[model samples]
Target: MNVPTVPMLFVEIEGVLRKTPDDLGRPWKGPFDIEVFPDAVERLRLWKGAGGRAIGFSQQGGVALGETDEQTAVRTLWTVRERVANLLDHVVHCPHHPEAAMPDHARCWCRLPKPGMLIAAQHEVSLRQQERYPLWMALLVARSPEALQAASDLGLDHLHGDAWRRDGGQ
Candidate 1:
């Protein structure tokens, strides 16, 4: 991967790459079943084919809420990655919720509303490859206002989930 020249795409798994929402607007209760949006795989393919590195990120507070365990939550991430043809370069999720029942998950930096996960991804890429990626060369693809806020905080370019999928994450 041309880590320096190509841009980075930070994708939100729920409501963007996958169809986990039901009619009530709540995500699937648990991570047992996984489903990818119809065009997500092709869109990701095009994004990667264009030399853009992709990272999957999400807010899996279910772990903190006692709805699921850390292992199960991570397993869902893997399932989504495989369903998308294994195109993602990295995947991260914030299992913490501010009012989480689990004390360990009550506070965290990598949560969606926070830019920690985004920063971690960029920082890791920079360190591992000894290459830097300017904020302009990165894009956060998601629909949530919280996610957009996080992108803005990091000065990373961003696009709505619909627009990105339509434009192949351009």
Candidate 2:
């Protein structure tokens, strides 16, 4: 019997920031700085080398309203992506508002509390690699327990909080 290799390491963006803005709604106003999770990155590399894949990643902070083009979001995520290219096979983002009153944003599947992004990534990877290998497991990384619980309720694989260090201090 062959053991199936699955994706590992889900890095949460935004909330992991070393600095927090007074207003969460508007974070791009000032010069924002973010710290990378070195330990998580290392783990990701190992998983990738072992034929593991990154099924899901979420941006807990920063609200991106409306159906903005993917380019805009990709640019914002590029910074995070650069740190874990080897670990990450794909990225999923929620560019919608959580509340219904926010018509400009509206309800969408990409949101964190929802598993649409993860599900989509899973399908993408399965289709992309089905000819070569089988998918056994998937992981989700969120900034809060709420997000993790939500992912679990949605049938997502192991969900974890945002905390990454090269030395595995946490």
Candidate 3:
């Protein structure tokens, strides 16, 4: 019997794996604000146990809002990564905001709805590694419409929370 190669899982960090801060109370300044959703973590574990890799895709617009910096954003993601340990393979974030005052974090294509980060991840985790998984078999677990659309454009299967939408909001 031939076992199929497991596909990679693309997860949205904020909102899906962790709750976004309701108020601007020291957001992403430290690891204190990080909270890993138990449900999401469990699901991620299942994927990992199945020989799959999981990558986090987050749109960290707080850097543009002046609430945080690239380092802070990375630290926060690392905190979450520590929680899940081996279950999570990598985490990528976008710091761009269209209206950001800082040019460094402004108007980058890597932001959600553009597919830059996802494309980067795709290249980073070579598709050839997962021999049994094709582009359409790659899975994305995110609640954001932009992520859903990006996955759709990339010909991937997407799940929003617990609901699986194959049509991809076409």
Off by over 4 Å in 1: 1-3, 23-32, 127-130
Better of 2 and 3 by lDDT: 3
Q: After TM-score superposition, what is the CA distance of residue 109 in candidate 2 from its true location, in Å?
A: 2.4
**Full candidate order by lDDT, most accurate first:** 1, 3, 2
Instruction: Provide the clash count, candidate 2.
Output: 4
Model 3, 1-170: lDDT tens digits are 46465577888876677666742344544666676667677778777787777788888898898877889888888888887654677788898887888777787879888889987775576654533446665788888899989888877888785453223223
- Candidate closer to the true structure by TM-score (higher is better), 2 or 3: 3
lDDT of 1 by residue, 1-170 (tens): 55356678899998788885662366575555677886878888988898778889989887888878999989999888888999988888888988986677898888877889888976776676666667788888898899999988888888898888777655
Give the alpha carbon lDDT tens digit for every residue of 1-170 in model 2: 44445544444554542223532434553222434555556756665687666643554324544334556666656656665563466666666666535765666766666666666766776667662223234455555675677657766554344433333223
lDDT agreement with native, every candidate: 0.82, 0.53, 0.74
Model 3, TM vs. native: 0.80
lDDT of 3 at 55: 86
Q: Which residue pairs show collisions in model 1?
A: none
The C-alpha RMSD of each candidate to the native structure, in angstroms, is 2.9, 5.1, 4.8
User: On TM-score, who's better, 1 or 3?
Assistant: 1
